[model samples]
Target chain A: MRQPMTALERVHVTEVGPRDGLQNEERVLTTAEKVALVRALVAAGVKEFELTSFVSPRAVPALADAAELVAELKDVEGIHFSALVPNLRGAERALEAGIDSIVLFVSASQSHNAKNVNRSVKESLRDFEQIARALEGSPIELRGAIATTFGCPFEGNVDVRAVGNIARHFADIGVRYVSLGDTTGMATPPLVSERIWHLREVASGIEPTLHFHNTRGIGLANVMQGLALGVDRFESSIGGLGGCPFAPGASGNIASEDLVYLLTEMGIDTGIDLPRLIEAAHVATRLMGRPLPAQVSKAGPRLALSDCSAVPTARG
Target chain B: MRQPMTALERVHVTEVGPRDGLQNEERVLTTAEKVALVRALVAAGVKEFELTSFVSPRAVPALADAAELVAELKDVEGIHFSALVPNLRGAERALEAGIDSIVLFVSASQSHNAKNVNRSVKESLRDFEQIARALEGSPIELRGAIATTFGCPFEGNVDVRAVGNIARHFADIGVRYVSLGDTTGMATPPLVSERIWHLREVASGIEPTLHFHNTRGIGLANVMQGLALGVDRFESSIGGLGGCPFAPGASGNIASEDLVYLLTEMGIDTGIDLPRLIEAAHVATRLMGRPLPAQVSKAGPRLALSDCSAVPTARG
Candidate 1:
């Protein structure tokens, strides 16, 4: 077998920590801190940052300052600022806040959708269509998100066909990108590959980005399988923050710093600098006042000896 | 790509938690407790168990009771009991303890060998040859282990050819099985596959088993990659016990319960029951006075509706 390509070879990482990560934290970050975190990530050469969500304050009080945070960071350059929008109202809010892109989420599992948004899967699809229609011809790039694409907390095994149907529908509705979310961290490598393959088959030429969680501690493994399937785009939170509030027992998203370390070490080109990302992880960990679930943050990078010690020290 | 076979379909798990795991803990488990843990694992359908090592007491004081423990459980049927033997003396001791199967460890990295066993790689190989020759033509089966096959803690980025050379040397010395150990948990899926492929090329017809550590938390992912490569036998510790005294920064070996759970859930065949393994984990945890590193132990098996109250009612 040949050596696989590094992140720089094919994939582009989209950092979603500031928005998706803090949106679920109990101690809500102030708008200033959120903006500062986003600025720090930008300084670290992160090209894509999901800033915040446009959901109702009651639903995600942690992100109530989404508009303010985006407004303050309006001058940051070289970063695509995106926001998660629940529906047309969310899309309108995001558009008004000057976000360059909007991400709409639809649950692949019907029971998950009913519990999360109080809507059936079809109802959520209709909402996504409406949001897509509302953003027609706008500068904002409308991206669809299929949450719980691997397996559902409410529904045991999610059919890959169901996920593909949603992806095909989104593609038909003119959505350019679809992210398959392992919302409850229920995905293993097999599940991740199966779903990605199904989506690739159904929506030929339209590749969906992968979003994984480390709740069950297999996030990096899932990422490897995704990479093997030729997926080049991924959504990850810095410091491994982010989880669905409606999904019980869900933990943080796959940490961006850890993901970058894995990719860069594999000789994959992820434009993000690992040391800078690690510095950002320190900031996030301090802000959270607890350890984040990032493996790289806890365990340093897989560095070469020249990079590690530089001296010919005797082995201990 | 086809779905990788489920854990129930392809793999047989060998629980190494008793020997490799307890050897690294600060507190030493009594010989009775170690025997009980092994008996519990056997009861849980573990076919192979690495009971203990015959190393000097000064080196690994935790397993000083290897002889007594083996003597206590001589009548356990349907289980293969193996022991780690470092050199000719250790091999003799293991044989005296009635252990017909023995695992000999040799470091692939010269730096690691110098640090770990105070011998050069060549010296270690010479010692391995002596041990293999001594056991030749007997009912004893000697297996050679190439440590740090993927990446080394001291050397960093071990060459796959070097590992293959060591494995080939072992094959020449009448060793039937060669096990590749990721001594430092630094391997990714790609690295795992590459090493397995190289080992297969170098040592044809000698079935290789994989020993992975979850220190950096990608153990199962590496296992998945190995499974895809047609490797069927693996070494795991109950409740993720085991650490390398030689590998300073390394963490526990991959958790047996978690590995079994991953395999069984994926429909692979380990022939081990998870709940019973968890019970073994509980015994080990109680002995250790802290929870071990098994992921499935902390977070139960990956089920869709674990918390659903209606499941019991519906089943009734």
Candidate 2:
């Protein structure tokens, strides 16, 4: 039997297409296109979004409008627009841009951390103290992420303890929400559940979300595992577009429409309109100048009948 | 916590590449390539295979060698090779070819039945009675599949009672093994579990297997759902290649390598070598003249490690 979702009534989604989705694309979107994308997502009932990255323009040129984009949409009602900040300087920039929440990341695997951020995990965690102190007593919210928590390209089978300790340190620095990243797409269901269970034991103060890649095509299985643990927060791309090019995984995120189909079919409210999300995917595809990798968008929804009585069965 | 696998010491897999996989391809494989594919699967310790279909050559020209393929490999040791049959004539042909096992299918939806096999669901069920009578005293084992058990393209949501009744009738006709086909990839985890649970009571004598298509990208999640219910048998294709093109769904099966990756990671004994299966997938790609839709084949396996140590943290 499937695990009963008696305790879980709704699932929260963090639409990460603007930042994570565009970061990996060869084609960059104009600031206007970015705004349009975000607006469409907001119109689709997306209450949460990682609107842009606060990293250096030289590092992520695609999101050069991080500050301008946030400033333009700062007064948007009912939506939580968060930005990804790689350091205290990025945090300062995000705050200057009037961003209310920020996501900071450090890899659980040392090699990935050095390659991803040019720093070690310890250095990254130690540097968190500065960001924590900087944000002390501020209205801004901080969420931490541990990449390669499931598996690593350089270090295979990352010990859950390493990710747990990093998560624990994020908690120590007053971070409340954290996510375990499958940067290299090494997440299986059992592995996902195992790490989530480890988090429950080691860092109960932190609310854990999951960021999965569709590299080997078990992203939803990992999400389902998180759901089994009553974890409903998922980070996904709009058109299922994106992956860290150097992340040792395939370039695909779990599609918003795909995840929405699973969520809505199970009667778990995502509050985002699935068809509108697919429309958002079409917008993303046009901007990226390539077809995205999402399944539901291309194949149509699982049950797409408008009038059941009008549908013709093949009996004739 | 992940589900325990105490009772599920071993799981059975039916490799359906030769029939289901090739049937949906534009490039029809030569008998030698087909034989080589099956040989590689056998070498990788695959103990069961659906080698071909007894459907007419006009219907599925790719599998015109139904008898030829079986006749070539019938003497192979220690593997259960099954052939799909549409009617008693096909069943007789399979038995004539000395096929040890045969699979017959009837869609649970009337529209799908009309389109797929040119009969109503009731007509298909009634015809199964003739196939049953013809095979009653034969050595050939019989299994039944209920297509569209989850949902129908023409009929939006297939009632569990409707599918349960089909499964019960299959069991009544002395079929001990029944598979539920996600013909249009309409299976969510909860829907899969619900239908599977109902099958447990209505056809307690029947061993249920799942045939999933990765049309909407939750195929693996559905498989994990079946795994949670202790349903150990699954039908998958090589390289995620194959689907009924006419079947109102996408063109990918849950890739054998991806499935093997999940199974081996969970300590589920599939008895097949995962890496070797991937190698076979490469061979399949070469034969198909184009890459198939499976992610693992192109992205490669999940746990890719190049260096064992010396990964530096982000700190200076």
RMSD of each: 5.0, 3.6
* True A-B contacts kept by model 2: 0.40
Ten residues in sequence with the least summed lDDT for candidate 1 chain A: A307-316
Model 2 C-alpha lDDT per residue in residues B9-113, reported as the tens digit of each score: 678888988877887777899888899899988888888888888887877788888888887886689899998888878888989999878888888888777
TM-score list, all predictions: 0.89, 0.93
Candidate 1 differs from the real structure by a C-alpha RMSD in angstroms, to one decimal, of: 5.0
Alpha-carbon deviation at A46 in model 1, angstroms: 2.3
Backbone clash pairs in model 2 (N, Cα, C under 3 Å; residues 3+ apart or in different chains), count: 11
Candidate 1 deviant stretches above 4 angstroms: A5-8, A243-251, A304-316, B5-9, B243-251, B304-316
Please tell me what DockQ candidate 2 reaches: 0.39
Chain B structural similarity as TM-score, candidate 2: 0.92
